[model samples]
Target chain A: MSTLAVAKKEFHDGIRSRVLAGLTVLFGAFMAGAAYYYTEITPPAGIQSSAEPQTIAVINSLIIPTYILLPIIGTILGYKSISGERESGSLKFLLGLPHTRRDVVCGKLLGRSGIITVSVLVGFAVGGLALYALTDAFQIVDFAVLTGVSILLGMVFVSIAIAFSSAVRSSTIATAGAISLVLVFLFFWNVVLTLVGYVAQELSLIETAQSQTPTWLQFFASLNPTGAYQTTSIYLLDNGTRSVPSNPPFYLEEWFGFVILAFWLVVPIGLAYLRFDRTDL
Target chain B: MPAIETIGLTKRYDGVTAVNELDLVVEEGEVFGFLGPNGAGKSTTIDVLLDFTRPTSGTVTVLGEDAQRESQSIRRRTGVLPEGCDLYDRLTGRQHLRFVNESKDADDDPDTMAERVGIPEAIDRKVGGYSKGMKQRLAFGAALVGEPELLILDEPSTGLDPSGAHEMREIVQEESARGATVFFSSHILGQVEAVCDRVGILHDGELVAEDTMEGLRNAMDREAVLTVEVNRVPEDAIAAVRALPGVSGLTTDGTTLSAHCRDGAKAAVINELEAAGASIEDFGLETASLEELFLAYTGDRPSRPIDKPTVAAGIDAAGERTEGHR
Candidate 1:
């Protein structure tokens, strides 16, 4: 009950702030623009729009931007969720109530997840309408799958950002740390893997001609939540337009992507909850 | 059982001690004032009591529950107005009260709380637009939700105008009349004196004095100082004033004479001087200010600016004096 109260207060605070409205308008615009680009602008041969339905083309174009924008928005929504309150001294009013520290962390997670969820849904609704009007090819199942995974992806980053927010005393440090994690997952994960492979080759840990991917490497690649989001979307869409190796291992399978996303959503928040419970605010 | 008790409670930040080994008790249904100057560990002790910060060592119990291990239960029955706390500025005053009411599982009407705090017209306004005093009042109202058994108010008078402070005291009195224990902290002596049944003075992380208002008043009354300007200083008059009862000390410098005396002894000192042919030009009497009262108890003034070599010895002697008095 106390956790829900805190969450209600948190969500109300989000509603009262201009950030939520701003994000909603920006997301609606972006979704509409993405649909408009595929249908009206019809960019060059690189998009392959002539070969596929307009809805599929719009979804394809959206994947990259969704991967990029959702994480940034999620980070922005959550980076200061705990540390900002702690620094500003409003946390006193919170802890002065009957709520436990666990209640606070869980409440923040639930509250921020609600904020990200609304923005994602609004974006998808606007995009779905645009796809209907512009192309007459709105695949409700496929669109819903992408929207669902996008929401999950947003929550994954919110959890990660809150982990940093709860671990540190300074909001600036939390912001820096959460954004650095997002950057790592968005860009550096594969580069770091390649570097590891090179160093392993130098150390004679593996042969140079090992072309087949190893099980351990497959598992490690699946650990990145953003990667998991894309794979999960592909699995759920089930359009059969993409190919996969026959009888691939479970770690390489798409179902494992949901598992990875769920892991990302829970583990960071769990660790942060433990740390925040012990901290002085 | 006592409403609040701390045994050997100590808190240290990095290497600096904020609250030293301290044992304190406030009985149920009493108005106990925790008095100290700023940065004197008053807030630190309150923090530990509420389990906002853990103690380095020792045990605390609030309302018969262990303060650290059973803090949720303790807090459920206690309403706290913490020091230096901020409200959610984007939230309206009504929203803040409703949140507290919901959190406490109470059905307090937000409008009633706002009216009680004297902010009825501003209940729907966001707290961001509130003046500091209004914010303080709103926070105080938030603490009143659920009709808590014990009220721990840390500097509740901060940011309040005089009338606001008086209203707060009346609320405290009303709460006390309803059988609630009220524990408040303040640096101002007169504010504490008005409502506190007893006050404990803290200095440098230790309690220097714990006495009822009557006891403190008696101590202050005994040491009232009188300074008189005279037309001439008579050598014979100084000896006569010194010999009078209730006058502890007499000193003369040129045509000025000062006497440290009981409240009743001022007139006798003047009579002695006038009879001895030293005409009095002017006379004034002074009771000790809170700073001087602190000096009387600690042998060191509460103000931080002046550093004296005697402070260390003063603390030791004051500790023994307090122990003997207890």
Candidate 2:
């Protein structure tokens, strides 16, 4: 009950501030623009109009934008949740009430997740309408799946940002942490995999030239949250969304991507709450 | 049980002891002024009582519940105006009050609370535009919801104007009269002198003195310098006062007699003056000011500027620094 109270305040605060409103506008614009790019603007360049909703033309474009947009939005939502309160000394005010530290942590997570969820909903509503207008063969189920998965993707990053916020006292460090998360998951995860793959192949851990990357290595790379979001979206969009064959190990299968995304959402906050609960505030 | 009690309470940050092993008690319905200079551990002690920071060793009980284990129950009945806090910038004062009321399951009217704290005019305005004093007032109003059993106000008058400060003191008195204990901290002596029923002066992480106003006045008597102006210096009165047990010293000038004594010696000296046939024209008595007594315990030499960095005492709550962990 107390958690809901804190979350409600956080929701009101987020909505009242210009940051969340700006997020909604920017996200909606991006999604609407993606709809045009996939249908009338680019059109996939071959089948005249493969602008079907469940096809690669629409869902792929929709999923690609979230890989980049959600991290930025999620980080913005969460980077200051706890650190900002600590800086302003308002955590003392909240804790001065009958709240435990656990209530605060849980409330922050729920509140921030709600903010991101709403932003995603607004963006998807615009994009969904555009897709319906643009494509003649739109599948409501696939579109609904896309919206649900995209929200989950954004929530994963919100948890990440909150973990950083709760674990560190300094906002500068938390901001840096959020930025580093984007860089590591969105950009550097591949570089790390390539370097490790090269080292492993050189050590003769696997066949050379036949495969520059091992099966285990490929499986591990695919679990990177950005990669997992893409894989999971493709999996949910099912039949003929893409031309790629789906014959891989069980660990490398698309359903594992959902598990990995869920892990991202739950694990970071769990670890962060442990550290936050122990530290003197 | 006392309203608040700490036995051998101490808090150390790394090697720096913020609060030494000190015992403190506040009875059920009195105003206690927790007085100290900056970094003297007054805030640290308050933090421990609220369980914001864990104590290094010892125990604390508030309203007969363990401070650490049962803090929620303790806090449910406690109202706090935290030191140096900023309100949510986008929240209106009414919103802030409602949040507090909702948290405590309280049904306070925000307008009535605002009126009490003198912020009714801007209660609808966002806190971002509020002056620091207005924010302080809003925080003060929030702490009053549910009519808490204990009110812990840390530097509650920091940004207030003179009238605002006086208003806060009156509220403290009102709360005390309603059977609530008000424990507040201040670096300023004047702010607490009028309303604090009992005061405990903290310096360098130690409780140097704790007493009522009268107790303080009697204990430190170098402050009681009495000067009597008569038509003639009364030799008999001077000798008789000199004979009193607490009369530390006495002197006679051309037409004035002065005595340096403790509490009870003054009345005897006055009686002797009337007996000696010396016509007393006028009289004046100067007791030690709170500032003088504060300085005496703080040991900050009056000749030196007060900005000197406090030397780390390197002592634990038990006194000397010991290596063994508890």
- Candidate 1, residues B120-215, lDDT tens digits: the string is 999999999999999999999999999999999999999998999999999999999999999999887767788989889887888878888778
Q: What's the C-alpha lDDT at position A112 in model 1?
A: 83
Query: What DockQ, between 0 and 1, does each candidate earn?
Result: 0.71, 0.66
Per-residue lDDT over A225-254 for candidate 1, one digit per residue giving the tens place of the 0 to 100 score: 989998887787656766888898877889
lDDT of 2 by residue, B1-326 (tens): 69899999988898999999989999889899999888899989988888888899989999889999999888999998999778899999988998898888899999999999999999999999999999999999988999999999999998999999999999999898898999999988889989998999998888988999667766665445556666776556667777878765565566666565565666666667767877666555555456656655664532222223321222122112111211
Candidate 1: TM-score of chain A is: 0.92
Which ranges of candidate 1 are over 4 A from the true structure? A43-54, B224-287, B298-326
Q: Could you tally the backbone clashes for each prediction? A: 0, 1
Worst 10 residues of 2 chain B by lDDT: B317-326
For candidate 1, the lDDT comes to 0.83
